[model samples]
Target: MISGAHVILYSQDAEADRAFIRDVLAFPGVDAGGGWLIFKLPPAEVAVHPTDGPPQHEFFLMCDDLDTQLGEFRAQGVEVTRPVSEQRWGKLTAIRLPSGAELPLYEPLHPIAHSL
Candidate 1:
């Protein structure tokens, strides 16, 4: 019985990133001893795809409407590192974290499994 998944994003400025997750993203998380905030993500789904190269794991935050979400993020002074590009599976974009790392964001055109 799997309970949940915990994803970690390594950052150079962890404290600033944590603040961004807390204040900007508005994720509800408890400070687990000395301000190590672990965010509570929404329902998640995973998929496996064939690859020709080396295997690697990637994470993306999904949204219902990418344009609206990007607009909201811009309003908060968040940098949109990549413009949205329509793919066969989804519309994708990237945002810059406080530590100068890029995090992918997408709105899937394919069927989603998160509700199940």
Candidate 2:
């Protein structure tokens, strides 16, 4: 029986990233132990795609309004590392984390599985 999934983001500055997630993104979480915070993500869905090369994993945050979300992020001083680009599947962009890692975001053009 599947309960949920836990995704990890490897960060160069884990503490700073954690704070960003907590304060900026406002993701509620529990302290695992001694300041180890485990964040709660929204409803998730998984899909398998065929790749010719080696297998790799990816993560992206989905939103309804790309422009509105980007505006909010910008207001919080979040860096938009990648500008919004139109994709076949969505309008894609990325944000820079405190650790200098970029997290992908999109407003899906195609129907999403998470709702089902």
Candidate 3:
């Protein structure tokens, strides 16, 4: 019987990170204890992909304004990434995590039939 769940991002400056969420993404959080702020996020779905080399989980969030989003992240001193081009399955960009991991940003590209 699985119930509601959420992911936690541990930060050196919890307050500042919380502020970023509040100001940028606008996801307010509850103070659990010791000044930990927890946000309510949508249920995440796992995307099937093959991998190796100490697997890390990746998440995809839909955004219409990726350019603006990249700008914001850059302004915050977060290193943003640019993938070379679109893939057969999807279009993507990336941003670096505080832990030096690349987080992929993707948007779907439909075949000719869907565009019509």
The per-prediction tally of clashing pairs is 0, 0, 0
At residue 18, what lDDT does model 2 achieve?
Answer: 100
Candidate 3 TM-score, true structure as reference: 0.60
lDDT of 2 at 23: 99
lDDT of 3: 0.62
Model 2 TM-score, 2 decimals: 0.97
TM-score of each model, in listed order: 0.96, 0.97, 0.60
What ranges in model 2 sit over 4 Å off?
none
Alpha-carbon local distance difference test for all models: 0.93, 0.94, 0.62
Candidate 1 is scored at a TM of 0.96
lDDT, candidate 2, 26-68, per-residue tens: 9999999999999999878887999999999999999999999
Best by TM-score: 2
Alpha-carbon shift of residue 69 in model 1 (angstroms): 0.5
lDDT of 1 by residue, 1-115 (tens): 9889999999999999999988988999988899899999888999997899999899899999999999999999999999899999999999999999998999999999999
Q: Predictions ranked by TM-score, top down?
A: 2, 1, 3
lDDT of 3 by residue, 19-95 (tens): 66666567766888987678876434445567877777656654545667777777878676775357785667877
